[model samples]
Target: MPVPPPLRQRILITGASAGLGREMARAWAARGRDLALCARRPDALERLRDELLAATPSAVVSLHVVDVADHEAVDAAVDDAAAALGGLDRVVVNAGVAGGDSLGLDGAEANRTTARTNFLGAVHQAESALRVFRPAGAGHLVFISSMSALRGMGGAMNVYSATKAGVSALAEGLRSDLVGTGIAVTAVHPGYVRTEMASHFPRMLMASDPDRATRAIVAAVEREPARAYVPALPWAALAWPMRLMPLGLYRRVAG
Candidate 1:
């Protein structure tokens, strides 16, 4: 039988204090993988670290409080975390926030924040992870892009969609550049995941739980697929039509 991939390898995840990031940390910890978790909230990180350590005493888990949007802080955090883990086998850049209220006031600031965190922050994490992976010669880089990246969703999600689209492009381009380097890049496009991010949206649109989304993400990373559309069928199907729809119709439908 072929040897299975080792789940004991060191894995680093950002935004692991809550939502999909937290769930991914839990899922990986259950598999006995050593984890280095980062998020803005130290208390939440410490709580999760304690919980995971209590439940899985054999797993090595360390939590760091750092915002991905802070380039210098992320640089230092990633370096220290990788050192603590001896080396990183996988880095999941999951720290992100939805663009500000697209429909109401504060839209401008929200869009700006969205761009800063979603696009620039992702770039920072990817660059930092590559710095580590390039020297090591092998690693996995998992980017948590959204299905919103597939098409421009006008009205409330315009900036959010643009940011995700940018990151998706970044992931694809990096995958091409990393060819034959033994490093794998996986872009995850998840649709309507049930999390605080979707709380403001209509309930009918939500499809999968955070745990379910995390499972798909972890599976995609393990398989080292070029791209993954979570909750597969319907979300994947929506991608093409969204891209081809007339601008007027797309706006009406998305709005």
Candidate 2:
């Protein structure tokens, strides 16, 4: 039998304090994978690190308190984490925030924040990860974009959708650019997931549990899939139609 890929490889995950990132950490720990987890919240990061270490004796967990939006800080954190892990085989850019208001007031500020956190932050994380991957000659990049990127939405989510779209494009471009380098880039477009990030939205809008969504993500990584739509049902079906729909129609349907 062919030898299976080692589950003990070290991986780095941003925004690992909660939501999908937290669940991804749990999924990885269960498989005995070492992790370098980063989030703005130090307390939560420390707690998660402790929990993972306790649950998986074979896995090593390191926690870093840093914000992805801060490019320099993120670069330093990634470098230190990569060093501590000896090297990184995978990096998940999951840190993001939703902005823009339904009322449209202060929309500029919201859009700015959204662009900075969602698009630029992912770029920073990816650059840091790739810096290590390029030299090492093998690694994986997991970008956690949203299903909203498939279509332009109205209401308070316009900028959020735009940022997600940007992230998706980044992943696709990276995949093409890194061809034959043994580095795989996976773009994950997930529908509404039940997490603190979606709490502001109606409960009906939230579709999948974070744990289930994360399982699909990690599975896609292990399989080295090019792109993935979590749950892979209505979401996969809706992607194209949503992209072609008019703004008015999308707003009415999305709202």
Candidate 3:
């Protein structure tokens, strides 16, 4: 049998106050991973830190209150977290916003907000993580993209989907750039996973509950693949078909 790869022990996760980030933190903590949890809500971060530490006494859980849209804050937070946890073995760029409306209908601000938070914020996180990882010569960088990234979407999903597409492309580009380095990059395109972020959107077919979705996401991160259609059942099977579907039919099936 092949030897198992070493698990990433020190992890940094943004948007860790709640939803998938929080759940992923719990999953990793259960496996004895030290975590640096970042989010805008200090109280929520504190509660989660306490909960994780209480449940897994051996784990180190540090909290950083940050708005990922601010690059300077993100840089400082990532560096601080890395120092707190000794060193970072992995970073999960998961902070995002779903706020956006129809284009050219006085929704520019909303669309821009989504774009900055989802795409630019991801860029900031990735840049900061690589700064720490480069010297170490080993790290896992995971981007939480969306299944919507496979194709262009319209209406409220327009800007949101576009940002995810950029995120996926960013991960691919980074993976290509780091070919010879020990660092690994993974872009996880998750299907409709029930969470606070997806609450406002109309639920799609084959939507997954949080627990199952977190399991799939964590499992994919552990594998550190270039890209993973999370759950790896329906989303993985639907990737090509979704990309190839005609606009008219794709809208009907996806929306």
Best model number under lDDT: 3
Which of 1 and 3 is the better model by lDDT?
3
Cα-lDDT of candidate 3 = 0.93
- Please state the error at residue 39 of candidate 1 in Å: 0.4
Worst lDDT run of 10 residues, candidate 3, spans 196-205
Worst 10 residues of 2 by lDDT: 197-206
Segments of candidate 3 deviating more than 4 angstroms? 1-8
Candidate 3 has which clashing residue pairs, if any? none
Please, what's the RMSD in Å of model 3? 2.4
Whole-model lDDT values for every prediction: 0.86, 0.87, 0.93
Q: For residues 119-199, could you state the per-residue lDDT of candidate 1 as single tens digits?
A: 999999999999999998999999999888988776567788889999999999999999999999999899888788767
Residue 135, model 3: Cα distance from true site in angstroms: 1.1
Residue 232 shift from truth in candidate 3, angstroms: 1.3
Best by TM-score: 3
Model 1: residue 105 alpha-carbon error in angstroms: 5.1
* Candidates ranked by TM-score: 3, 2, 1
